[model samples]
Target: MQENKKTIYSWALYDWANSAYATTVIAGFFPLFFKSYYSADVAATTSTAHLGFASSISSLVIVLIAPLLGSIADVYSLKKRYLFLFSYLGILMSAMLSLVGAGEWQAALFIYILGNIGFMGSNIFYDGLLQSVSTKKSVDFVSGLGFSLGYLGGGVLFSINVWMFQDFEFFGFEDQATAIKASFISVALWWALFSIPLLLFVKEDKSTHISTTTKLKDGYLRLKKTFSKIRQLRHLSLFLVAYWLYIDGVDTIIRMAVDYGMALGFDSSNLILALLLVQFVGFPATLLFTKISEIMGTKGAIYLAIAIYLFIIMWAATMMEVWEFYMLAIMIALVQGGIQSLSRSYYSRMIPEGYSAEFFGFYNFIGKFAAIFGPLLIALVALVSQNSRVSIASISILFIIGAILLYFVDEKKGEKELKDALT
Candidate 1:
């Protein structure tokens, strides 16, 4: 089957749109804005703690319900509906950040938590749409294109925001706070405006026998059936376990690398520069990985990524020079998008027909829950050793475990199982 260019563009544009939140709010401005505006009266530690708590709340909410939502959406042909609801909710909540007043740390946390939920929950259905939008042969390339474009789109807006904040007066804003607030609105607009393409062009396929009864009763039974499918499908269980371990290591590195750099006496400027470098370099690097997957096979390419991460973590643990830090950043840029995009596409290929949304819910659940553990491991290791390097190096164990397990996942067998399940 030939790919639909319009649908592909629309799907890719959604990544370009929502990535502003990932870049600007999640990674860049929100922390500083929260500290400066909301916690001016309290200690910096208190504000930072609040941010972490809010983030945890968001993840917890999604982990508990993502599978249920995904299952229900699949049974009722509601992928686009759920996507619209969550995306708009996220957009509204993101824009509402502009309304938070100074000295309102509690309110800021509330809004941030809701906004994050809206953002993360929507991805369940978005990832599930992989089956609807592309073919098995093209999956890796399409998935890589989305991530590659995401890196480029997010980097551009983030850079613009940085420049705008640095020169508030030139942008006709009187103060930094006001300028930051306006940028929040910009993210909302950017996400909303670009999302129109997906909403208008792409559509979900609901060819399986759907429940004609009430959605509630249907959803419950559908979810139960999904649970049974997992029990019967050994390959899926194996893949999920493998993904949970490896992605934890991958995500932990992304979250901790900059902070670890800070711990090692690098300036904030150098750290931010590294973040930008990852986003930009990821554009081309993701495409390169797509080709690599085509030539070496998906599993082979993924194994390559795991091996590189093993080296990167060990290198970071022992590094001493500023130049070496840049090298570590470049290494991350090379493999970060590849690992995630490939993981998603690989999972899509293995899921039973018409169960993409429900199954992906479990996928997202493992991912979100595992995220909690990775950070905690680093924290525990740091407390015990009093050395950030020890904490960073300890994460490599997760990749090693994941890679070992990944070696056992037979994709050919998994595909056959999905086909039999559907028949």
Candidate 2:
């Protein structure tokens, strides 16, 4: 299918929209605010455990409902509607965060859980709509475009939020805590405003009208068939396994990087600056990575990214200075978006037509489920050895194993097999 510029741009802009939540709320302020503001009365470790528990609950919810919802959306051709539904839920929850007062840790965690569910759940349908916008030949560029714009958009708002928090009185806020609360509202507005393009311009396949009871029955049957289909599609299965492993390492590093920096005794302000560096650098680097994929092939590009990540892990474990941590952050910025965007595009090429949402659900399922493992591994290693560095080094195993499995995945063969199966 030929790409529609309007549809493609609009579809990509949704990434530009929601990433404000990812950068500012998820990665930047929420953990700090939850720890110092909401959970201020509790012990530091207690707050940490509570935050971790909330994260697990959100991930668990998404893992449980992802494929089932994806299958149902496919049956009803309701990807767009589902996407907006979850996005709004997230948006509403984000706005609500501003209202939780001091010492309201439980309420904060509860709303954060719901916000996370909305953020991650909506992505299932958003990813499903990829085929509606771009063809195989154009998918790489289009995917890269979305991620690049995401970096830029998320960075822009996060920078302003950081400024607002740093110089609260300049922003006309009474104090830093009040400024942080106000930042949540900023993210909600930014997310809502940027999402308008996709709502207005992008389109999905027309929804199939059916009785609710039949829809549920057909959706359940389709979900079962999808499980069988994965078993039959050997290379697709292999890729998912590989994806689950490496992406776990990727996500673990993303979620844990700041914590690691703080563990190493770096100031929080510097760590936040490093994150800003990543956002700005990632924008151009992601586009460059797409060009590299064009030259080296998608798998080769992914392999290169995995190699870089491996090197980063090794360096992170041994590094001493705060500047060294900044260097590692720059390194992560280089390949982070490349690996992610390429993986999505690569997977897009292999799945059967008309089931993108369902397959992407499985894709997300593996990713979300894998999330639970890496953090636990880190915790376990920290408990047994009492070494944060050793725990950080442990993640390299995921990349190594993922790369070995990815070596055996033949994308050409997978596409051929899918076509043959369909025929």
Candidate 3:
């Protein structure tokens, strides 16, 4: 048990390491910097549209490849190698963000897509690492710990970047653009520095069943076989479908909420503060919700999380003040990590051991595909309404529909099926 705890902590540290990319590169500085510096020289909204399109394209590619890569890793016991490969890909691209210059919109977009692909692809393998590290009893708490540490780590680095962006002159940078670009360098360095623990400590299982060449071939073939077998797992399939829709809403909110706040005239400081609040608040709340899941079970906790999300959407729609935005941030922090952690743990509980990577590949398939709709919806609505606030409000429908479907799922039955399959 002590060894398991050590392994879990090591696993969670990777979350701590990489989340800086999500917070700084994805959420905090990059978008604003892109628009102000790299994209400003381009035609209006072309940069924004290009970013969306690039992300969408990369997401689609990852969706197609994730299952195959996961299957290959499982068959050949190459999970750690895959994790390193993708993590380095992200690191290389993140480091390249510092090189983006004015009038280099195409290059910027290409780098962003590469970085995003690396970020998303690494997560597929990182998530698969969970099965090898811990059992069902510890999954929720450990997953929550990862998210909590992620929030803490990402927030700390982002706060530093915010300070730098606000005070660029202190560092001999001429302006915000230079500081922001430098922040990308920091993100790359920080990610590389912190990732050492996991790479050093975590061990991959050995698979004697297949050679490397055959593993590659069999991985693709197994993906086809798994797709057909998915039909046999009715309840699990339904849950994946439901998770796909609802998690889309969640992902959309995380990606676009800051942009929405900025559009509503909130200053960068306030936006940063709000995000910081969410990070700190998420830390404890995530652990508490994990405990609640132990008492109430995964489905119940998820239902509660979905309910909270509904309230946040309604609250945001009616918000007219900065304080109100802060309030909403608190609400999101309380449930966001919990929902995501519990969902992953719940799904893990339902999958058989030998096929964990394959099953989670389908899980990633849903996740990647789900990520598409909300952003596209936001972009489309912003295009039509020219009102980012109103566009964001439209996300409520996803939560409502997701919550209703979640109610129909039988958690006990899913657990039974998973155990039977293992036996």
- Cα lDDT computed for each candidate against the true fold: 0.81, 0.87, 0.81
Best by TM-score: 2
lDDT of prediction 2: 0.87
Q: Which segments of candidate 3 are over 4 A away from where they belong? A: 1-3, 41-48, 207-213, 415-423
Report the poorest 10 consecutive residues by lDDT, candidate 2: 43-52
lDDT of 2 by residue, 1-423 (tens): 427888898999999999999888877788778767898787644555566567667877888988988899887888889898999999999999999999999999899999988899888998998888888889899999999999999999989988998889998999988998898999999989999998888866678878889877888898997687678988988999999999989977876677677667787778888888889999999999999998999999999999999999999999999999899989999999999999999999997778889888898898887776776667567666667799899999999999999999999999887777656
- Candidate 1 segments exceeding 4 Å error: 32-51, 101-103, 205-213, 256-265, 319-322, 379-387, 421-423
State model 3's lDDT: 0.81
Per-model root-mean-square deviation over C-alphas: 3.0, 1.7, 2.3
The deviation in Å at residue 355 for candidate 2 is 1.0
Q: For model 3, how does the per-residue alpha-carbon lDDT over 1-423 read when each residue is reduced to its tens digit?
A: 223766778889999999999989877676666666777775433544555566666678788888999998877777778887988999999989898789787898789888988988888888888887878778887888899899889988988888888889998899988888888989989998988888878777665665668877889897777776666666787788889888988888887777677667777678777887888888889898999998888889998999889889888877889999899999999999999999998888877677777778778888988777777777777777777667778988888888777777776677676556445
The digit string of per-residue lDDT tens for model 1 on 35-56 reads 6677777654344445545666
Question: Among all windows of ten consecutive residues in candidate 3, which has the lowest summed lDDT?
Answer: 42-51
- How high a TM-score does candidate 3 get? 0.93
**Cα lDDT for residue 216, model 3?**
76
Error at 400, model 2, angstroms? 0.8
